[model samples]
Target: MSIITFEHSFFTYPQQIKSLISEGLVDFGAWYLMNDEQTSRRFEGLQTRYPDRRLYPFAKRDDNDDIACFDGSDNTTVHVIHDFANSGWEQKEIFPNIDAWLEYAEECNLQNESS
Candidate 1:
């Protein structure tokens, strides 16, 4: 799989995200982190779709296609954007950094396995 590296032009991924990608630990319960190529496409698509928001999409929910992206100006902050919103799109600050997001993802996986 294509991993985000320093050469990536879209955005400089925070260390937490880079480490996870390097380790090949992209899957987290219902979410799947996009490879470098997918991320590039997703970023370009979002730029056209929502010019007002600067999002660097890295992961997405399999169930509803909610996007997990980093703030363009600040790679550390992560947000989940609603892709299927009926009355336009909505976004929420779900994690302070990629590390927190990974923790949440791992927790969800554990919960799923328990069930």
Candidate 2:
């Protein structure tokens, strides 16, 4: 399982998107760049280079990182940090950073690996 890290949260709005693109923080056909048609078009010209890989955006409704057993097929799942609600820890606060979220993911992966 390969994980890509973005400097900003997935819910980041417009200007941040442009800034990320300008800064080369995202790659063409990457989920952060090709998740939407508007952004996807920017890489349409390079489709031949990345033929097999289609971008899959993190689905907002199914944002939780819970695992579901699927009938043996190649599938991609994205775990967005915003989906988990802060349960009154530090007065019900939320920490929104990819680094923190990635740490959570690493912990989950570690537990899964141990089990």
Candidate 3:
């Protein structure tokens, strides 16, 4: 019943995503996916706009891949996982949109409340 709020959507390669999941950092609860080009542009824009914001690239496949995951949080925060390809990544089955994710979260919350 936890609610995860994202100021932006994250896009990365398969291996990095897998590592994140394996590390228990981001659980596949709910998530959104943007195309690689869109993600790159957005990431660049954010970097230019907010130079002070510490950006951590979430790369797990030997750090040579063009794909990257960025973390702009202070502590290790959980993100809803979505759009994962079957490249040896393990995650919980969940929807791939904000509305559906929120709906599921709300349902779980309501169930907990009733119980």
Candidate 4:
């Protein structure tokens, strides 16, 4: 089993996510794992000061601001951090799971490449 080492706990990743990391599709250093290097990028650097405000950051958004996180408490549903109209900041579900999230990310990558 592949494990990501951290001070508090070791993080286990899904097979598909592991594959993406191996394939260089996902930045494991900046996503998937919570290391010192990634702390600043998560939640657009908000997590450093407001750790209570984050769900569980997994990836960064297409705009390079905000973060893609998952609700580790209730359900492991994927969420992207965003500033809503009146809600201020929130975890917006974009995909159901890591698999679906990866597919969406691939689509975005392709779009960026083509553009």
Candidate 5:
């Protein structure tokens, strides 16, 4: 049900992500993919605020301000950025791709739900 429906032509999500969406597997527990407007707005804001980083935000954590974004240079590797980080991109955690991120998100969700 988390499959995103983008209105804008700005969908540069990785092929793996697209494949998962096509297979109806978009939800990752607490991490939800953003809608077109949300993605676009957050992408713009992130770019302006952190010009050194090339990030394309696609998802956000429901409980906090953390965001999951694709590396704009490759559109494959995923980065999880923490809002509390004063060092900005330095505090971002890298995942090999959306697949790894999905696994991590699911694990985190399970832990959160059990507690």
Candidate 6:
């Protein structure tokens, strides 16, 4: 079963991301929506140390051992940073945008249900 829990009230996430969570659109395993601080702490060198770009991490993939996924501010793409001590994100884009990501998440959850 997929669970939606929000505990990081001290920080604010993107508007579209909040909408997806509120509307019950996300079910990518256990979505651990973390604030900037928590995300930085968990992901280590990848997020916090990168001074040149903005990476706002909001969730991790529980099924995938909490691989951190974050929002890249300039573009509509959400990036996946799978490695620790890496200054920048991996070359592949996690999702094109929030809307498309949510749709794919929904599909992934549905597939999990039939498994």
**TM agreement with the true structure for every prediction:** 0.79, 0.27, 0.29, 0.54, 0.81, 0.53
Task: Return the lDDT, model 1, position 33.
Answer: 80
What's the lDDT for candidate 6? 0.55
Q: Which ranges of candidate 4 are over 4 A from the true structure?
A: 1-25, 28-36, 40-54, 83-93
Query: What lDDT does each candidate get?
Result: 0.75, 0.32, 0.37, 0.52, 0.74, 0.55
TM-score of candidate 1 relative to the true fold: 0.79
After superposition, which runs of candidate 6 have C-alpha atoms over 4 Å from their true positions? 1-13, 21-32, 35-37, 48-54, 66-72, 85-92
Candidate 4 local distance difference test against the native: 0.52
Q: Is candidate 3 or candidate 6 better by lDDT?
A: 6
Top candidate (TM-score) = 5
Judged by whole-model lDDT over C-alpha atoms, candidate 2 comes out at: 0.32
10 residues in a row with least lDDT, candidate 2:
65-74
Error of 2 at 100 (Å): 0.5
Q: Which has the better lDDT: candidate 1, or candidate 3?
A: 1
Candidate 3 per-residue lDDT, tens place, 1-115, comes to: 3222222345333343444344654432222233334455545754554455433333212212222234455223322322233332422333443335435555645665687
Displacement of the residue 96 alpha carbon in candidate 1, Å: 0.8
lDDT by residue for model 6 over 15-108, one digit each (tens)?
6766666876554554445544656555454445565645555566667633435544443566655544355544344777766765665665
lDDT of 5: 0.74
Q: List where candidate 2 sits over 4 angstroms from the true fold.
A: 1-93
Better of 3 and 5 by TM-score: 5
User: Which order, best to worst by lDDT?
Assistant: 1, 5, 6, 4, 3, 2
Error of 4 at 76 (Å): 2.2
Residue-pair clashes per prediction, in order, are 0, 0, 1, 0, 0, 0
Native-to-model Cα distance after best TM-score fit, residue 6 in candidate 2, in Å: 10
Candidate with more favorable, higher lDDT: 2 or 4 = 4
